[model samples]
Target: MRRYPSLVMLMLACSVAVTACKPAPQAMPVDPEPAAPATTAAAATPAPVPARNECPYPKFDAFLKHFGNEITLQEKATADPLLDSHIDAEAEPEPRKVESRLALADVEWPVMPDPAALAGQGRELQVNTLADGQRQVQIRTPDSSDQQTYTFAQAPCWTLVKREDESI
Candidate 1:
């Protein structure tokens, strides 16, 4: 997907103006590659999206018991076949397909942080329940230099959920 230079400039400017504390996520340049023939029935329809928009992770004491905040996400990035990058001339000039799949069994879950471990520490955690039922957690550790905030949601982009403004 080719982005317009002017539009990209505008977005960059807007992001710079809006976020001064944290780095804004920049859009990755999309390079469309050729697609291969689909032989399976699963390839006929598009991949299904999550049914709900709520946080998929457990929260509060339950979170501490099971998975304590530490999480990792794995994704498969793909684009249309509009470039020659996916083509192989020496081996089968005819493109069969270009795809990568991640098996559920292949995913390795990280060790979750124990809430009890942070009990005696001066770190303070503030969990806010939003109107949309998602939770945003703000962590202000003993070191006043840096603070971190994260949101949890059912969508793949759980961290980008809106939060209550604390500008006042």
Candidate 2:
């Protein structure tokens, strides 16, 4: 075996030099996660309930009175996709009832007449409760052929679901 003292010393010197020139080890940077939005009293509040589920009036009569006058209340009291029926006098066969579903946007407002004001306007208004607890309101002119019937059902509160216009 041959001993290379100079070679060993040279290798040791090179290793020391390399170690001295090398940069110190550093910890990797970490990014923090975003925080959630704060929940205040207003933010934590529940969504508004539908008008059909709320009954501010004790009787149907009072509800109808307010429903006809207030446009906002009337819109809320009316059902979406309302069932609209009218006589189709121009049908191929004899005149027949044409039924169509009308969306909230398509529905004409103020279709209902206030019972209290009907008599004053020289129009007769009759409200009858059906066997199924639905209110049928019939509005008619004294001698004119104009007439309209509105049907309201109470699921949790009175809501106008259907309208039949027999007026020519």
Candidate 3:
């Protein structure tokens, strides 16, 4: 009986020792290329183009006509008045919230009309000329009550047109 207990204890000790003495698994090799010093000259990055100050003066009537078609299609597909109401209810009354939620409510991403089609329509496509000569175009929906302002070189063009204003 004494010998049996000692043999079991010795077996346990041997197993523990074998496990403890086992060598740690080697780590997989990694590529050293990323750490290598760059030998070639650093490529020169191009300077960023400054934003244009003027809006593109597109043919407003033609642009609106094209935009209207796109808006109509979009409205037919996913203009959920119920969803709009829910969004409005959850939205904060802040100006940014109103602007973001309502800005596109009435407009869709306008399709770029072909240059030839625009020419056939007898409409000139001029982008809003920024002070820096970059052209931009903005679309305002009829529900927008906020005054939209565009600035060129810190100069402001206030009271351009209201959403209800048909002058565009």
Candidate 4:
């Protein structure tokens, strides 16, 4: 009876040791994680949009009317049109004299002459949208007048781009 008890205890210990040394059963196969929700076309691609809107000028006169009018100039924020770039590439170029009525629109401007209200001074201001899609405003003062041409190609605002004294 004593030997039978010892034999039973040895067998139980051997079985427990064998089970502990055995590798854990492999995990059962599962559905491939739902295929990660397929990437939609909209999610993968970006929307196409134009960089800038077309220039909005019905008539050049109406557009430049903002230049001579005090209230109009204030509403536009920019007294004179922005100069995107200069036409002449000279290192030291002569100053382009734009008229006072229009020049005074930019009060703090130092280089340009913003004299007294000269709209009543009888200066012929001509604005035209060129065939190349730039709005050209020409200001012709008496004989000493310079060829100062402005362009508004980038936006609705005018830009003084070209100037050559006595060219016109």
Candidate 5:
């Protein structure tokens, strides 16, 4: 009877030990379904480009109006007969209206005059662009001579070349 009880206890302990030593079963792997393909068109559409406004040359009327009164006063004092004769001899026969139009085309604002010319004339020219897109040109002639300044409104981004010596 005593041997039977010990044998039963040993069997129960062996069964518990075996169950404790067993490894757990691994879980099965599950894969997700494949994603659908992206749709395609026959051709790729391009975005439209915005149109730019045509930039006109600077308004010469504004320039003339700004400096004309002052220039007229100076011209009376410094009128040179010989230089005037030479200028007239070389001048074109265009009417004042045509000349004004040509001058408009020649005076593209924001352009610096020839540095060499200014140096030769012993003068200094300074240009400044205003916040409102106008350009102000200040010219100081030789020996700090009477300063002449002009403001050209509605100017364009281009280089300007004087057509004649008188144009300067």
Candidate 6:
């Protein structure tokens, strides 16, 4: 897929924003009073370590940069048997809601739109971090109902799990 100038600018801006918003590492405050020594019994029993999500690249912005630009990375990051939901345009009298799974082998490459291309075509792109912690990337034509939303979840690392096509 060709890279558009607008898309490059968008990604660059996102990168800068993410970098700018990161909090600087601060030095741990020094305690005037020393912490109490643990008892021998307490030392014998090791404190339980909290489990953590170990995804190397946990930031959605970074993941999205690759997702839009690289097909192989997108395929690898997407969930297998992806949940695809949309209106079935083939219905006899009227379109009907349909839900299906697209196995990794069956998925058409580059399902995601290039934001630059969309902008060039006079479509608008909106990205939101939903209340439920999922990220939604939506593209639509202004003043029109033509829209699609791609929902992603951080299953350890970001993964494209659902797509909702609302376009007519």
What TM-score, over all chains together, does every model reach?
0.31, 0.65, 0.27, 0.35, 0.26, 0.62
lDDT of 6 at 51: 38
Segments in model 4 whose C-alpha atoms lie over 4 Å from true places = 1-59, 71-81, 84-119, 154-168
The residue pairs found clashing in candidate 6 are none
> Ten consecutive residues with minimal summed lDDT in candidate 4?
109-118
Q: Best to worst by TM-score, what's the order? A: 2, 6, 4, 1, 3, 5
lDDT of candidates 1 onward, in order: 0.43, 0.82, 0.36, 0.47, 0.41, 0.80
Taking the tens digit of each residue's C-alpha lDDT, what string does model 1 give over 1-168?
156888888888999877775654564434423333344545898887665333343334454334453443211111111111122224564534232332434433332233455556666667787797666666555545334454554334233222221211
Task: Give the local distance difference test score of model 1.
Answer: 0.43
| Per-residue alpha-carbon lDDT of candidate 6 for residues 1-168, written as tens digits (9 for 90 to 100) | 155988988899999999788865564445634443445557788887533355545787777767877887778878898899888778879988788998988888896876657777999878899998999999899887688899999866788999889876
Q: Which is the winner by lDDT between candidate 4 and candidate 5?
A: 4
Tell me the spans in candidate 6 whose CA falls farther than 4 Å from its real position: 1-56
lDDT of 5 by residue, 36-57 (tens): 2222222344555533223222
Best by lDDT: 2
Flag the better candidate by lDDT, 1 or 4.
4
Candidate 4 per-residue lDDT, tens place, 32-108, comes to: 44544444655777877534333233344544554444443433434343333333424356534333233434434
Measured over all alpha carbons after superposition, the RMSD of each candidate to the real structure, in angstroms, is: 33.3, 9.4, 14.3, 11.4, 18.8, 29.2
Residue 48 Cα positional deviation in candidate 5, in Å, after optimal superposition: 20
lDDT tens digits, residue span 1-168, model 3: 576998889899999999888866664346656544443323345555544333222334343344434634333322222121112334355312222223345543432333335545544433366676433333233444322222112112111121211121
Give the alpha carbon lDDT tens digit for every residue of 21-71 in model 2. 886666433432322334454478788875753587648989888887887
Model 6: weakest 10-residue lDDT segment is 28-37
